[model samples]
Target chain A: MQQCYGSIIRRQRHFIRCLGGDRCNNSSSDTLLLLNDNTRMQSVMSRSNPAIEADALSILRSISPTLDSTKHKGQAGKIAVVGGCREYTGAPYFSAISALKIGADLSHVICTKDAAPVIKSYSPELIVHPLLEESYSVRDEDRQSVATVVLAEVDKWMERFDCLVIGPGLGRDPFLLDCVSDIMKHARRSNVPMVIDGDGLFLVTNRLDLVSGYPLAVLTPNVNEYKRLVQKVLNCEVNDQDGPEQLLSLASSIGGVTILRKGQSDNISDGKEVRSVSIFGSPRRCGGQGDILSGSVAVFLAWARKLVDKEGHTLNPTMLGCIAGSALMRKAASLAFEDKKRSTLTTDIIECLGRSLEDICPVG
Target chain B: MQQCYGSIIRRQRHFIRCLGGDRCNNSSSDTLLLLNDNTRMQSVMSRSNPAIEADALSILRSISPTLDSTKHKGQAGKIAVVGGCREYTGAPYFSAISALKIGADLSHVICTKDAAPVIKSYSPELIVHPLLEESYSVRDEDRQSVATVVLAEVDKWMERFDCLVIGPGLGRDPFLLDCVSDIMKHARRSNVPMVIDGDGLFLVTNRLDLVSGYPLAVLTPNVNEYKRLVQKVLNCEVNDQDGPEQLLSLASSIGGVTILRKGQSDNISDGKEVRSVSIFGSPRRCGGQGDILSGSVAVFLAWARKLVDKEGHTLNPTMLGCIAGSALMRKAASLAFEDKKRSTLTTDIIECLGRSLEDICPVG
Candidate 1:
């Protein structure tokens, strides 16, 4: 109950700051960090929803901060990718590295024992943990103990992560998926944001209760994956006609978990409103592109959530993150494709990410 | 579909206001739309194709947009090339990328699922959809369901496109051709213009009902393809002595669908008249030039259609599109040949599309 009122108080403080009350400062002293005067809190609570749409640009600009020397390492973001098994290592590495490239201060990859060394060898910048146990590695008798151990290890650092990207190269090992479910439940309890993609989508579709009604959950599905999702959630075939409206229904049905439907164009919705980012990216249907997208989204989402905690931006932070991530991913893919043509690989696109973000939102 | 018409109306208003009409302020109130005295529409319909022989320079000058900060994304045009397959990725890539370099704001490629990745690898500027299917990929039992899926995928994007350049590198697969036929029917219903070339000519030559009387359908066939069309429609051998008259009859035979007959001097007709674009060109007969011409024609046709919607341009938009496309393509080829001589390839000419257009139609 105290947690509920703390969030409200945060909102009240954000409202005061947004309205230019000038009662707040950059001090992080208060227990709940209320910088402004308390007089506006009652009036703000009296009203229902006080959301206004900025012309789109300002909302994004505000979400992405102007970094300075005053900022610390973790202040920008600490992102984690929770997927990697014996069968796959590249997927988690692509996703984790993408978060760092997109401006996240720290990127961590949680994977199984066999996958950890390979993923770590890909980049020294990544913090790889071999905490997950796949079915082949663990006997059925020890499954319960193993799950408890994995969760305890993850819980130790769960609060430090701004966002967790689930299901990069996460293979479909029954034991692994079951443990991930427990982690998801714990993350939900702590209210950590998640951007689910690839094999992670497979896990979520079957275990809807894991993410159902979780506002901070985001699902990025490819063309085929999206078809399956529509079939399962809407209990009907994917309606190509009225796609935007259908997407809205799907998100609402999932309790407003943001869905970024990846296709010829990207359409995003968080149940309340449908937004799309049609900034043409490279046409390469190469693998690993979606991993890049999930990681980029993780970083952007963390930043937007921070903005929501401090400022009174009414737009859904998940939707905004999807939009920014999609646009930057596409712009970078386009730039990579321009130079390399068909030879443009996911690594090449990853190489272009830093310049691409700088091009879109200049630090200066 | 409404958005397509709304864009035309916006272009009409912009064109009128640009011409110093003082007629419609930027009120966005559309009740005043049909109130433009009905003068332009009447003049356009009464002239009977008015083949007044617009000069080469003027045709291109009016076709290309004058680049400025005032322009919106699709204000220039949005073009899509409905082609590309396992055997033919480069053709669609050349066509779609040419549209972008020629100043179309957006360019897209719709190709077979196998071809999508390859074509996407070519450039990031084009939005590539892996929506098409092939005969080998589909089982006889799944044909119906697959066709429906293909059409639905294309339909969702049909209205957003200003023009579709069909058959650049489209293989002669029966299943793919059948699905494309359905797409043509859908595009005709939506009033989206199409420029047919390469294998598209082969498809329509056998299935005239696909284009039949659709006024916006553009069939751009080479000398050999034009001969087949003439033999199928007119039931006679080519009459070289009276090429223009024969071309006019072929277009008339197809109920006035625009036909751009390629040769040393490009001939265009829409049943009522024959218009020719004569420009000096390179002796190097290279492939992919036709793809560039077809893509260019699609963009020019969309722009010319907007001009007709406002300025009462008497010549059919398809004819103007062909004239402008043919002139610009030949000039670009000539410029590339001038520098590279015998070594000039299709890529060289594509590289010159922007400079060639600017030379003829300066932004200032």
Candidate 2:
């Protein structure tokens, strides 16, 4: 009974913070951090009904800072994608481009040298950095020096990025993964939020220490990725019958780090409770759609994180980010599919992002 | 009753063919060819009904072939517009130009030599052919050779053009009109479909034989041109009360040629039946909207033709083409109106064409 009462009080506190009058209007990172911490607490306690879902959306809206003219260039959001290699430039490009399209002030892509120019050719809007060396390009003697250079380069930009999307097109390369692991550790040290996906999941699944116990870290894994994570973390295969319970266990095992499991319904959790976003989405399963989702998550996460810090609102920015990103991506995909039908591509969905956001939360 | 039944049977057959039924599948021109042919039939019959516009959005979706990276350039659709004179460069430019904006791989404009430089200056994307001759440039003695040269030049490119849109900026020059007449004849002989509008409508009303029995000709006439068509084809005045029937009869009377009578509701018919595209359109009354409509029809006709060929469905491709074209044009116009409001121009409407098409048929 004491534990239940404690959970209820925490949820009520989050609800109050969501309604926390004028301070929600500020731009300071402390308020945003508070909001993120409280929202995370509320999500941990309030998971029984659809009202929890409504609460999630409201928290997102509340914490998403207003776009103001006085704000500097990167105030809105500076997102970086730590992915992209040979044969997969389109994924990282899609992820980074999606962030900008969704109103992020700036977006950067940290990819391998081979993938940089190709992703750059896809769009001039992105700042593509060709620093990471893949296994095929690295020599045995030069591995240590190459790895050091990659880490130092990523460290320079770590503080500037509000959020990092760590998967998309990251291929499975031993040298590359090792370097990214270091980058993840440094980001955690700086208290920067991270959303892991794509090949990043492959690395994280093997080296749980990289994200385990890092509260700001977010693992956005699709079905296969989530399955492996569950098996590795929970020591069991997927149990569809108790999805929420398994997800809760997975998040708890990761030491309160957020987990956004992508499926027909996106289930979000951070050890304490689980929330599902099962909004309408297109049935057409074209490739690279997941890249858009990862990119969107990064931007929203940054915004949510900032809002939480500024408001001192006690909610998990990562959880709020997952909900908002899932909703927006689903809405955009539905809007695109309505027009394109079976021919709807990821780019088409990306184009509808602005319109879909306007539809939900009108900008006056 | 017998005659009416016969016409109805023909209309139904055309409708089935347009829907991409078995009968029209194997035909060379495919669904686009069938639609152009059906539109010619509708023009010949000149029947009327206020309510029966084809399901153009669906047709557009059906006919728009899937985009795959494996496919090379020019496999989608290639179109050309024959218009653009010294005084009216923008009209032909609008017509020939909109084709590429809506995803046609290649769009060419065959205009007078004097109009070529200006039209080319408008967009480097277009392949502008400077092969047409105007009366001011040719002496009476050289008229025949000039006409032959123009016809020969157009003929060289005719086989490559999936559809032709005649008369956007075509001036009221007798010599140029005569050459266009010969060009139309060759297009008919080579079984190339034509979408006639602007000055081309003026030429067709005077010398109906250019499209008399050709099943691949479509005439897009505005309020005034429609009036002239009613007077010339049915030897009667415009009857808005029986507009659908009149359109059906007019299409049938011209040997199954299709007629798209543009208005608040775009009325389309072949001799067999009538379909109307009552989709919402902007009230902006912009000048270049008609050009957008003509170019859109060309693309839809091409796409509908291919859809019916591959699916082997029996529905009137002409009706489908008109419906799709009218729906898309209206959607673009409506979207432009929302943004530019009363200040909307043709160029604004043209830009909206892509979004409009994307709205109806996403590139999934």
Q: Candidate 2's residue-wise lDDT over A65-177, tens digit each?
A: 67757889988899999997753566788899999988898999999986787678778899999999888788999999999999999999899999999977788888889
DockQ value for model 2? 0.03
- Measure candidate 1: CA RMSD: 13.9
TM-score of each: 0.55, 0.48
**Residue clash pairs of candidate 1:** A282-B124, A283-B120
Evaluate residue A233 in candidate 2 and report its C-alpha lDDT on the 0 to 100 scale.
90
Q: For candidate 1, lDDT tens digit of each residue in A1-364?
A: 5575477556544533443333332224322333242323332233332111112334456678788999889898999999977656767888999999988999999999977866777788999999999987899899999999999999999999999999998988899999999999999999999999988899999989999999999999987788899999999988765576678789889998999988655778788766555555765454578889999999989999877354665557898898788878888888986765533457778999988877777897
TM-score of chain B of each: 0.84, 0.86
Q: In terms of docking quality, how is candidate 2 classified? A: incorrect
Q: Write the per-residue lDDT of candidate 2 for residues B1-364, one digit (tens) a residue.
A: 5576456455545554543345333434333433555544453345443243455676778877776433434556789999998898998888866787676766788888788767765653466777788888999999998888888878878898889998899888999999999999899988888999999999999999999877778899999999998899899998876666677778989999988989877888767656677677899987878998898899888877767364543456666677788888999999999999999999999878878877888775
**What are the runs in model 2 whose C-alpha is more than 4 Å off?**
A1-56, A308-314, B1-364
Residue A209's lDDT in candidate 1: 93
The superposed Cα distance between candidate 1 and the true structure at residue B215, in angstroms, equals: 0.9
The two-chain DockQ for each candidate, comma-separated, is 0.03, 0.03
Clashes of 1: 2
